[model samples]
Target: MTIAEVSKKYGLSADTLRYYERVGLIPEVKRNKSGIRDYTEEDCRWIEFIKCMRSAGLPIETLIEYVRLVQQGDETIDARKELLIEQRKQLIEKMEDMKKTIERLDYKIEIYDQAVVKKENGLKRTYD
Candidate 1:
């Protein structure tokens, strides 16, 4: 597929795709004879993986390192696994922190809700 097709399919801007390639966030894309990018299935897979990792809040440097490791062949298998494990550990910690924040917000909202109910009840009593 062309870069435009890939951009539309992946919901990324064309510039972002170009930037990813330039920054080594992804491998270099093969261009057609006309000097236009023709992304392959493997390229799309890398984009998908990179998008997923980015959404999960993985650092760019971490992803770049992971990609580098992948390019280094089979010797980096254990290293790759360790990197993923560390990232997972960090993601879990962030999730836990977000959960705590959500709980706190819920509690605050419930308090406000109760106060509103109480005020409405008091007003009804006064008017009646």
Candidate 2:
């Protein structure tokens, strides 16, 4: 497929795809004899994976480092694994905090429900 087809298929801007290529976020794309980017399914697959990681809150710099490590062959395997593990730990911590926040919000809503009910019953109250 062409770049436009790739962009539409992935729902990414043409410029973003170019930027990814330029920034080393993606591997060097093979071009045809006519100097057009002839994208293959494999290229598209990597684009989709990069898109997923980006959507998952992975930083571009981290992604760049990861791509670099990947291109370095097998020597950086341990570092890549450690990076993923660390990020997973952080994500878990963030999710736990979000869960606590949601619980607090639900608790507050319960209190607000009581206040509204009491107000409807003509039992006025003041809060400091």
Candidate 3:
């Protein structure tokens, strides 16, 4: 598939995909004779993996390192697993913080809801 096709399939802009390649977030893509990118299934798999990691808030520098490790062959398998584990740990912490924030917002909203109900009840009593 072409870059545009990959971009649409992955929900990322073409420029972002190009930047990912340029920044070494992904390995180099093979170009056709006409100088257009022809993404193979393996290339698409890398793009999908990169996109998933990015959405999970993994740092670009870390991802680049992981990609470098991958290029080094089987020796870096443990390193890659460790990197993923660390990122998952961080994500869990972030999720906890977000949960607390959501709970606070819900509490504030409930307070306002109760106040509005009380005011409405008072208004109804006055009218009656």
TM-scores for every candidate against the unseen true structure: 0.94, 0.85, 0.91
Cα lDDT tens digits for candidate 3, 28-108: 999999999999999999999999989988899999999999999999999999998999999999999999999999988
Candidate number with the higher TM-score (1 or 2): 1
Residue 42 lDDT, candidate 3, scale 0-100:
93
- How far is 51's C-alpha from truth in model 2 (Å)? 1.4
The candidate, 2 or 3, that scores higher on TM-score is 3
Candidate 3 residue 52 Cα shift, in angstroms, is 1.1
Cα deviation at 119, candidate 3, in Å, is 1.2
Error of 2 at 66 (Å): 0.5
What do the candidate models score in CA lDDT, each in turn? 0.93, 0.89, 0.91
Worst 10 residues of 2 by lDDT: 119-128
lDDT of candidate model 2 versus the reference: 0.89
State each candidate's clash count: 0, 0, 0
Q: Give the poorly placed runs of model 1, Cα more than 4 Å off.
A: 123-128
Number of clashing residue pairs, candidate 2: 0
lDDT score of residue 23 within candidate 1: 83
Itemize residue pairs with steric clashes in candidate 3: none
Question: Which pairs clash (backbone N, Cα, C closer than 3 Å) in model 2?
Answer: none
Query: Best TM-score goes to which candidate?
Result: 1
Better of 1 and 3 by TM-score: 1
The candidate 1 region of ten consecutive residues with least summed lDDT is 119-128
**C-alpha positional error of residue 49 in candidate 3 after TM-score superposition, expressed in Å:** 0.9
